[model samples]
Target: MNSVSRRKFFGLMALGAGSMAMLPGMAFGAAKAKTSAPGQTSLAAGQAMARIKALIDELRAEGRAFAADALASDNNAQWDRLLNHYFDRKGFASISVNAANLCPSLKPVNRMAALVRDLLEADISFPMRGELAKASLGHGLTAVKDWFGLGGSDAKADFLLALTANSTMGNNFVNNGLVTSGFMDPQKDNIVVWDVNHPTNYDAWMYRKATQGWGADSIRILKTKMFASSVTEAERKAGTIPSDPQNEDEIIAALLALVDERTKLVTLSWQSNECGMVLPMQRIVSELRAVNKNIHIHADSAQTFGVLDLKLGQVDVDSIAGSFHKWPCGPKMVGILYMNNKHGAAERFTPSIWGYDEYINTPADYGFAASTGTIDPNAKRFSYLGQQNDATLVATWMAALFHTGQLHPGVTPAKIEARIHYLGGQVQQALFKHLPKVFPDFTPKTAAQWIATPTSNARLRSSVYLFKTPDGIVAGDVMKHVYEQHRFAIANLKVMGHDLLRVSPTICNNAKDVEDVVAAVVDVILAMKKKTLANNTHTRSYA
Candidate 1:
């Protein structure tokens, strides 16, 4: 087939048009073109052509200099220069920081664009496309294992599968491992979740949705006594109780109390999304296992995956779900689900979608025969979805390379973790010292009162930090002002009824960026306060 026909053929296949049998006289490499054809100018064909043209146009429009620099660079200095150039090109020339929600890096985008450009231009056949897709998936899986510090021989013990996003993986675990596995009693069984801090909607809300119809009492939340309102406001007024409390012991006790023989599954984020509070996974797992050995434990590693040095071989969880877009600075619409296959954990959950490996169809002697094929007892079972974007998988591998220092030397996981923590601590200390100075009337002058994130315990610190806005000022308004006025990107979120502003600095940021962010926030807060006071005075004058 020529280039145009090949493009159209693949586009039609993507649009669910029938096989080659339907396209009469469409030979693979025919020298003569047939003037007459069967429905060659149909609407579906025109739509397919337009879609392919749009994709090609997009690929051509994206910047290719980053990819070119990466390919040409031979030394660490060159790679560093390329990295800076890439970030600047992505509109991060200023003090923008939104790594907690989504990374602003362009490494994954460049890699994906390059691969997609080549694939679209090449006259690749269907069989070759399948080979390339499987190869990309294999490479991506290997990179994921390496990110978790797993050896090649450990592939059978641990399996990794890709999904569209983190929420899909979380929902899969809840539906397959808890509800559909026939382990829950609905009346007696309940799932325990750390409810003090706000986990991602994927973790908390997914659990709620999964166990919705079981019963009103099917879900049990474990929270700190301080967060659960066990302390009175009178005590807070008297300064007898710490406004911000590091009640890990209380949280653990509450979690243990909630877990019993009836508890089926326990799920929580490895790091709290509201305020970078790292959960004590070791203690939680060990103690919970003592209560019920058959209990299933799941960790949503969205906030911890690429920023934290995690060795899955040492972690004793049944499953972990994480996304690459946040900390890893990888492509969007791609996430990973890791299952422990050594302990038969992978076999417990059935495939949620019927992919290529689900079954086999054959013709019987008399009629038709359809038999169930041997489902892969590993992560491959979950990855059998009909079609997937191969370029995205390759881009994931490229991101892993960039993160692990293959593409950028001296950028190992340890250095990345240290850099992130250092930046987070800088922001935390700056806010703690400056917020009180700016707002002298702000009561309860404690780090815990203002900084919603736990800072008393060093072990619980993470790259993500949250600050409670001053009274009479909305966090969302501050967030918008900072971004719109100063070109700074931060997050303002309402978690558990408390409004807080979040700042997360990643590998793409520097100390200068941190200083600028702090100053911008302070400037915004003071300006907003002055405006509010003037408005109140004008209202009084008019009255």
Candidate 2:
């Protein structure tokens, strides 16, 4: 890759088709404010990124030693290192590439939005460029409130752009936390249950109990299932494990016996992108903040954000959504939603969005006509739901400068969630020893249930795992015939109701990219078992 070989870098990008039209997303040409010259707009945004430096020299020839060198088994080098780490070259001159030569002042997009509010701890000037621990969801809600003693709860954190940390940002944080937690007496807020067992986070709290006003008896269903653990060393020498008829004290006593006292809210997903299973979510947000410290928890950490070590200022929540292109290689409608400034407090969060002055929660002593309106007491009052662009909000500070490794200190979101729970349990013990010699109907789990240590025989480890499906094939057609015969990106998904195959590994994955993706899923299940034993001996020689 370093020698520029994607067929000689698409044959030198066929000698510039107008510099490959800013090569799609960032070679920029449309920003208008004609009157050039003031370092001629950072030299035509560094000469349109020096003619997009032959696509940043083919993304610095595939890898610059890191930037999540594409969670390996070479998912076509993690989709060309998530598109050249979001087209960056010295953070693409703070990503203002030629909107006439961009940066028509929001003062460097408010200093890259205060360097992402100082990498989520605010006041930030961009220095911690190595072990990147600064306020990533306030250090993952202060490591789930000092590992669940819920250090005197009440949390606050905010940033926006979420999609799969639960869709429509988990139904607008349970319909704006039941219209700013007044929870208007429906038989005293008595139902908001979850767990059609993680049907994509119980169909987002059953799509706000069937479209708005948290109805249909607020919500119901705690019947859970998502299992996968088949532990071994002879099932840990016969101590056995996969008995998951839904554990975690039976999903926290089926979500604390569907908390009556007119429950406010309680979304889930501290883990379970279809069963990699972690859900303790600090004993379900410290036993629902000891059963109602104003319940409205919301976690949906879409496959557990940047791989756990989270802090969110001591974990008993009020809100927290996730997404930054999973396991934080960042970009893709970037996301972060952490409310709890006393329920987005600028005096009990009233601004649903007021960039044009619904008086964004006024109080500049309502004088300069309360300076074109107020609002933002937290969770960025659901971060401006409409037009607010300073080059995609300064490319969310070059995707938080490649997630606080200042664009490349060789990746960190706590080192790619401890290399996706120890190289995703060594690619699930090399797919439980090459999937029963190429599909005798494989079913794996438990090389001591993927070892990331919790010991009462193991619990904390999610890097993503799963297998089943050989019987009548069709899990997306052997996942597109092992990704068109072994380039192997992997993952088919749909957990408890079958499908499976999901692998899941990240952080420039080593161990020979999990032994070249379990030897290309054993050469794509031995070429679909020698074309299904030559079509069952040509259907017994045509009967």
Candidate 3:
């Protein structure tokens, strides 16, 4: 009997069972072995299939039992062990802490590989694939609802899976909904957003193309100051200013002042990607609802969805758009759009991109009767946008399971949040204690001035820590030099004209990772500063 290589088996699997029949040197039955072509399979391929199938079944069952047992156990030590095991399996490096941009875990990648194998098995036909894909989507939605504690009472709220990024969903809510509802008069009506919100390519399209088409003046952005630089020097020294200033009542009041009878929609980033400043969502939503019950509130929850403990049902928002690739450690291009259907909020927006479902009538009438063409009343209406990668969708459900501890019981969303914040605190403390010593010329003295993120308020702080770079050095130049020299992955962003280095440590990181990143940053900045000074001295001698 010949042994089948793993690569060959997966290649056969990728070809699928249907395509395998057309291969030149292949045999399916035992009796045809003698007459089969060279390098072909007869009984060995069958045995390989059987062995692989058994292995898959055993692993799946064992995983389920292990998760159940772990969840049932009350031992904290056991829980910690399982958590470490999960992180170790991901094969993430400690020095690479860039979770704010994308998760570095290989768990989703491995799970996706397994899903592809399962999906290509003999029993799964095309129709069966569709059924399984829908089931996975349903599982993901249920997991999201359960995590947010919106299981029973908030049953009316539905989640729509967007094939595009979160920005498309935002556009659908802000531009399409307002235009379709006829609630906004181009001459008088306006929309409100944060001035420092992270602008995506879709935002550029909406602002330049969509708004221009509607003849609207401009999208009104709230200039709510939330940075340490926005405060006076005395306030910085006295520690009167918090890192996250958006939580203040005065800031909220000023934001609400921009909303008049003409304001039809208000969109806000629940957490700023620039500085990780978490907005007071519940308070903002409640006050906005008090002012106008019909106002459409859309939250760009890209930064806070998986990292923060969110109760979607509690917050009165028309829609919340986010993606799983960020903090959820899921596959890319998988976005979620949560529609608050309790108050008929889901019906306000028509589909921005038309699909086959949009043309179909209710009850899917295909007979000769006169049909009333209507889009689906549920989230399914947004899902039927042509062909999508079903494998990625199923992997998204697996990713959700991974986070909620259904797949592995040791790690939960709360634990992940705690780990990220703990690492974040370590980074903050290291920067505050060591930056001045390394450079000796480091200015702004106070931690408030040194750190762009919120330091005074613990509740407002997130895993994302944006700190100032040296004045003479460009943040981007320092970021590139650090990655090239030290292989550390961080971000350099300019928000509201302030260039800063962003360090977002996730659950996979440790205290040591934080210390190493801070130390590497200091070394890189110092080296760059010396080179700049030497060059300046040479130029001065020539002058």
Candidate 4:
């Protein structure tokens, strides 16, 4: 992944932070893993990582070669072997690729991505132009009836191939939803969202109302203060969820409280990237719909995309945009946007980047008349952003399959959540015990409050934890000492005027990792204080 184009970035002057995998030991079409060593159950981590590097080199070469070979021949049998070999993993259903299930108009990179998506059973309804592109895209789209609902009437969010940058997708979804709901057309509409100062939930709404000089429509922001470190202590000790009677309800009511006929759209986040705060989206959507049935709801799920399960059938959000790199452990600079076309959100979502229109034969069906006009009726309307990294795009599916399929013990999304929450809870509990003694000035209000995860029934928390230090202790200096001395690369960030320490615990991390980081943090803070005292003593002695 490389720097996103400034043009694309400027489009996100407000929104949230943007943030792939493959399998091992197995091949496609009933191929078995040959034993490298006798009775070898699995490869070592170092070996596994090295294999991934080698695999990337192989994929780049083989993918390009296959595309080139695919170009010269029209035979489906020829390319099917190559596609199935690289794409087919252990857990997923078998998939084959050819002109019938590939987006023809796409450049080779995008075509490879289409093949990966085809393996994931995500149909293509993209709006990219080319007499060749339309036919190519449709071949892939016609494969799956529903991407997310692979089983019975599961009614989940579908998989659409959206080759977009992360921050750009949030604004795209929100603005498009608002526009389609007749809010952004100078019609007076009230937009309600969170004001944690995160770009996705906060400032993008600000730009639309303030930047566009639309003074008639109102934007009410839901505001909340950061909970104290003590809160985490109480929750951990009690071994229960926080009873923040005032905080949770207030946040939900504040947004739903603003709903009325004038309210046309509401955009929010599933998790805050800066703080590991998970909002009660399930309930927030539930209450919002009850109040204003017409409000178009969109969620920025960059941090929670691969972390959360297929519960969208309950939340019923109109649109969700997320990145592959963060929790999914995939590459960066790639984003996935899912729309609720199954539940009638298709007509309500108008693509902001309606760059091309060639997927559907009846253009009028999707509000487009001809080649240069109209958005696709499906979420594919948003997939028309110009050129994209083909390798990274295709790798998204590979990474998705790797994590959701191959990441062991905690394999499914539900299991993954449990592992992360357990790790995060460990850090939360340890910090509660260590922070006070480490910094005498630190007096938190709640014991285990930061362990707050909004999904009550799921108990699925983010793998991230945050702690703020006083002015005398520079967070960057502490971060430097920890990284340099202890080899612990903890994040030192400034959010909402507070200099904070951010820690993330994943499958790669465990209780020992948390203990090591806490110990390092204690040493760094104490060392800084000792150095400060010595300097003060030297200055006084000289004075």
TM-score of each model, in listed order: 0.74, 0.33, 0.75, 0.64
Give lDDT tens digits, candidate 1, residues 1-543. Answer: 654454444444433422211111112222232232565432222232233234323433343334443322123344455457545545554565767777764554454546654654552445345333433454445656676766444453214554444545644645554555456766668776665433443354445556555676576665432222134444433222221345656446556766778887787778777656777787878888898988878777777778887766667777777777788878776777777665556555665565331111111211322264345566655655555565565566556655665454445676667767777777777776668757664443345656666677666776677777677777777777787678888887776567777888776666556668877887887888888422121111000
lDDT of 3 at 393: 57
Per-residue CA lDDT of model 4 for 384-440, tens digit only, reads 665554345545544554334321212355555665666666676667668776656
| Global fold similarity of model 3 (TM-score) | 0.75
lDDT of 3 by residue, 428-527 (tens): 7888767896546554445666677777666677778887776767777777766777878888887666777888876555566678888888888788
Tell me the whole-model lDDT of each prediction, alpha carbons only: 0.58, 0.44, 0.58, 0.49
Look at candidate 3 and give me any clashing residue pairs.
Answer: 243-454
| Winner by TM-score between candidate 2 and candidate 1 | 1
Predict model 1's lDDT versus the native: 0.58
lDDT of 2 by residue, 251-304 (tens): 466567666566766666666555455666767778877877766667766566
Runs off by more than 4 Å, candidate 4? 1-161, 180-187, 228-250, 356-372, 406-410, 441-445, 448-460, 532-543
Task: Using TM-score, give the best candidate's number.
Answer: 3
Candidate 3 weakest lDDT stretch, 10 residues? 534-543
| Model 2: how far residue 499 lies from native, Å | 33
Give me the displacement of residue 125 in model 3, in angstroms: 3.8
Model 4 whole-model lDDT (C-alpha atoms): 0.49
lDDT, residue 445, candidate 2: 41
Off by over 4 Å in 2: 1-180, 184-261, 270-297, 302-320, 323-326, 331-335, 338-393, 397-426, 430-507, 510-543
Q: Which stretches of candidate 1 lie over 4 Å from their true place?
A: 1-86, 93-95, 106-109, 156-158, 175-177, 196-212, 224-248, 356-375, 441-445, 532-543
Evaluated against the true structure, the overall lDDT of model 3 is 0.58
